[model samples]
Target: MPLVRIDLNQGRTAAQLREIADAVQEVMLDVFAAPPGDRYQIVTEHPAGQVIAEGSGLGIERSDALVMIQVFHQGRSVEQKTRAYAGLSRILAERAGLAPGDLIVSMVENTKEDWSFAGGRAQFLTGEL
Candidate 1:
């Protein structure tokens, strides 16, 4: 599952969020080859005053958006992860209406033993399981 956290300047509508989701889903599907039916995303909007940016030590100025995407998967190689991050960053920059340097993505890979789903009732035993 991919947990996407999008932090944008507080002025976006529901339609904007949906559009971002669509663009992100497309990147996930095309770059990571993730199944269309198997994807998860969470979009969070933060005001400029609350978030602490990297360079400015302040919230994003202007109409900038801070996107922090975290991806979780099993048995993925470094190359795959790299490609996923790169593809996502590129797509978000190109399609999500963000500056190229504004998007930041992080990924964490784990074995099947690390995660549980379905209210902790089911553990992912393998990629297929």
Candidate 2:
């Protein structure tokens, strides 16, 4: 499973936030090949000034509608990640009316040994996942 964190400035309603989160989850499913119904996400909306997203000199415009996504998961290839980023940009724009220019994404990888679903056991190692 990929755990996704979506950080954006505070202006959207709860339904809108869920739409953004769902958009991220869609990328996890389609591009990252995560299993269905394995969604895990944290959507945090900061006050307008709290989220400072710069254009990174790429000239991509930043806005309060900026969406920063960090995905934590295991063993996805570079190609998968590349597609995931593209998919997020496209899907978020389609589903949430978010500008592709206003999106930023990052991924972090870990091993199965690093995850414990419950009971202090590594579910992947224990064949419980």
Q: Which numbered prediction scores highest in TM-score against the true structure?
A: 2
Q: How many residue pairs clash in each candidate at the backbone level?
A: 0, 0
Candidate 1 Cα misplacement greater than 4 A, ranges: 56-63, 117-123, 126-128
- How far residue 39's Cα lies from its native spot in candidate 1, in Å, is 1.2
Task: Report, for every candidate in turn, its global Cα lDDT versus the true structure.
Answer: 0.67, 0.86
Model 2 per-residue lDDT tens digits across residues 14-77: 9989888877888899888888887889888898788788877888888778888888999899
Best by lDDT: 2
Task: List model 1 lDDT by residue over 57-100, tens digit each.
Answer: 55634335666566666676777778877777677667767775
The whole-model C-alpha lDDT of candidate 2 against the native structure comes to: 0.86
